[model samples]
Target: MKLVDVGGRTMAYHRAGAGPALVFLHGGWSDGRAWGPQLAGLSDGFDVIAWDAPGCGGSDDPPREMTMADYADAVAALVAELGVEAAHLCGISWGGGLALAVWQHHPELVRSLILVGAYAGWKGSLPPEEVEARVRRLLAEAERPPAEWMDAYLPTFFAGAPPAGSLELVRSMMLDSRPGGLVPMLTAFADADLNAVLPTIAVPTLLLWGEHDDRSPVGTVAQALRSAIPAAELVVLPGVGHEVNLEAPEAFTTEVRRFLQAAGATLIRVSRATCALCGQQAASEDVPLTWMTSVEDGRKRLYCDRCARENVRSIEGKLDPVYW
Candidate 1:
């Protein structure tokens, strides 16, 4: 839960893992903390960082008027602050467009792109009628109270019932968001059309969508992304919905890990950390709050923040990392 200063605003982020950096851009409803599954799943071998984008989570809200480009700039600033020259940008929904914008403006900072349930912005990916429909729906929702807004918005995020408590979790996250920011953020993205940038992107791109994603179905947005991006890979998970990562994390995790690994994009950071012996659950920290790597293997692992300060140690090496 560390915060970085980006453009005079505090941007909250989660950092973990021991390999090439994977920066996650969350959808509109959920912020960086929503990437719990990804932060855990990918951190095993990749440096995973999820940002509470501007106007969401603990980050500062954008001014009354700001475009999608402004969001992109904040992302670029965060990446630079993290000292990462280049990283794999993974975004879902609105975050996907933000990721594209990052590649659009700051190409050097992105090694690859992974978009889930993404759009070129409504204007860029959908027909005129569909775009209009979304605008009206969003505008109407903006007028409602947070609880009502979330109640109305939540159903569209899924095809049917999702995991227990998922709906509630999303509701809580949405409520935590500021209405003023959400409206402007919505307006900013709705008008954005990065269709032209899709074909021009040189990095490897992976597009993931839920088969039953009615919100941003595969045909319109997903198909357009696949067709426009050169040699991009597209995967559709059956029974899943628009919130691909949350609704089906295991599947989403598998696709991303496989895609990045195959493209040779997830090069493990050839660095290690050593620390005083700690108790079992032997999670080691390589980059302090950024990683809690396992020491079961030969890769010298450091202590995770939690296990680091403990005075107890295993003299017999019997309390190995694998026990956890």
Candidate 2:
């Protein structure tokens, strides 16, 4: 367990291994420990950091009035404090919403995105009536004894039966929840509608969803996201549910590892690319590279940070670099 101060709040995170930063954001009612399999399993090949968001796990409770922007800023601050220039953000459920918020606000700090059983926020994806009902149910659950709700909630968490000890694992994590944290975090989730931010995302994105996910069904929510984000890839884990990582950890880990390795290779290619405008070489793979599809041949062309900044408009317009 490691701690950092972000915006005067104490944030706790579990980190392992060393390489390109791969930060995990868990679903609502869960904490960083929810990512235990990922943190330990993927650490061998990449730096894996799982954080207990404000009001969850070892972190301090956020104010009742906390908004999505506040959550996004705290995440960006935490990553910067850890000396990670950019990270591949992997989030599930509500955490996936937070990941989208982070990318919407801090695009420069994100390398790629991995969203599992995610939402474009309830408002962005679900019917208004359904969103309200879910919000009310969650709020009521926060007020009840953990045991009373766990039995009912546990059934919905998985597609069919849970793996041995999986039910206990989820129960223990939910027992640690408090209303102060739960209400505000979930409220932010319900209110968020990041549909507008989807088309603007330029980074590589991988969407993992359970084929039988009840909470965020792949057909509606996942397909909507896939259609919205540019070049996004979707992988459905058969016989899984919203808790895809818990029920199918091996398959989940494999998909994530393959996606990240491929994304890393693209970064390596970007590192080797000479700036078409300035003929300058990138200092490292981490250096930012702006890639534009050639209007004529559709091949990707690279520009270094300086040249990219100087002609941002031209690049946005997809005008040929030769003309710039």
Candidate 3:
């Protein structure tokens, strides 16, 4: 863990490897340590940094009145302090909202964006009633013992039972979350509405989602994001849930790497086409395979027209076509 003072607030972060900078911003309930897998896995290829935002992990509690813009400026200060010219910001959930805030406030510092189980903002993606309910729940949960609430709440973040130790790791982080920090950190997002900011994004943006994400359901939230961000690509991890990074770390990391590489490429040229779901080959030169760029590897994925139409809803929902 590294410590830096940005505007009198001591922000903490973890860094590893060396290459183009990749910064990870965790969700409301999590701190920088939640990105352990990403920091370690992507270290060999990039300079990965994960920060514990104000009120989370080793960072100090923020003022009750702290705004998302304040958080964005804090991120910019940290990046400037680290001497990085630009970076790819990858954020999940509330962190995703912060990433949008950063892009809005500090566009020049961002090279690209990767948002997982993300939202434009609570107001931008969720219905007004749902947003109120979620904020109310967060307020209630902030005062309850971590164990009592997490037992029932945490399951909603995963597709099924979490792998052994996964739940424990998240539980420990939630346990460490202070109400002083958590309340402010969460409420800031509750009041945010970045719908206007979405259309202004000029950087390469990738939207990753868990097919069964109950909190930020792919069909509603992810699609709203995709339709708003011009040319943003969406990839749905099958059988995954809201905690896309934790539930499918390898896939999450791979997709990030692939998106970064593609974003940096001078030109995109396809050599062959095959259905990512059915493994069927495209038969003719004129046949167009529906594009699905972020598969496990670097190959460009395309679904046959037959498969595409049959599973159009799933594809639009960004689910693994296999499920269709």
* Number of the top TM-score candidate: 2
Of candidate 1, the 10-residue stretch with the lowest lDDT total is: 315-324
Clash pairs detected, candidate 3: none
Candidate 2 per-residue C-alpha lDDT over 1-324 given as tens digits, one digit per residue, 9 for 90 to 100? 788888788999999999999999988888999998888789998999999989899998988987788888888888889999779999999889999999877766677899999998888889999999989998888878777786677767899786787777899988988888788888888898999777656667899999999999999999999988867889999999999999999999999999998876442222234565787765655565566544544434556667656744333454222111
TM-score of 2: 0.83
Q: How accurate is candidate 2 locally (lDDT)?
A: 0.82
**Winner by TM-score between candidate 3 and candidate 2:** 2
Tens digit per residue, CA lDDT, model 1, 236-269: 9998889888888888899999998886633222
User: Between candidates 1 and 2, which one is better according to lDDT?
Assistant: 2
**What lDDT is reached at residue 22 by model 3?**
95
Q: Which ten residues in a row have the lowest lDDT in candidate 2?
A: 315-324
What candidate 3 gets wrong by more than 4 Å, as runs, is 266-324
CA lDDT, candidate 1, residue 140: 80
TM-score of each model, paired residue for residue: 0.79, 0.83, 0.81
Error of 2 at 299 (Å): 27
**CA lDDT of each candidate?**
0.76, 0.82, 0.81
Could you tally the backbone clashes for each prediction?
Answer: 5, 0, 0
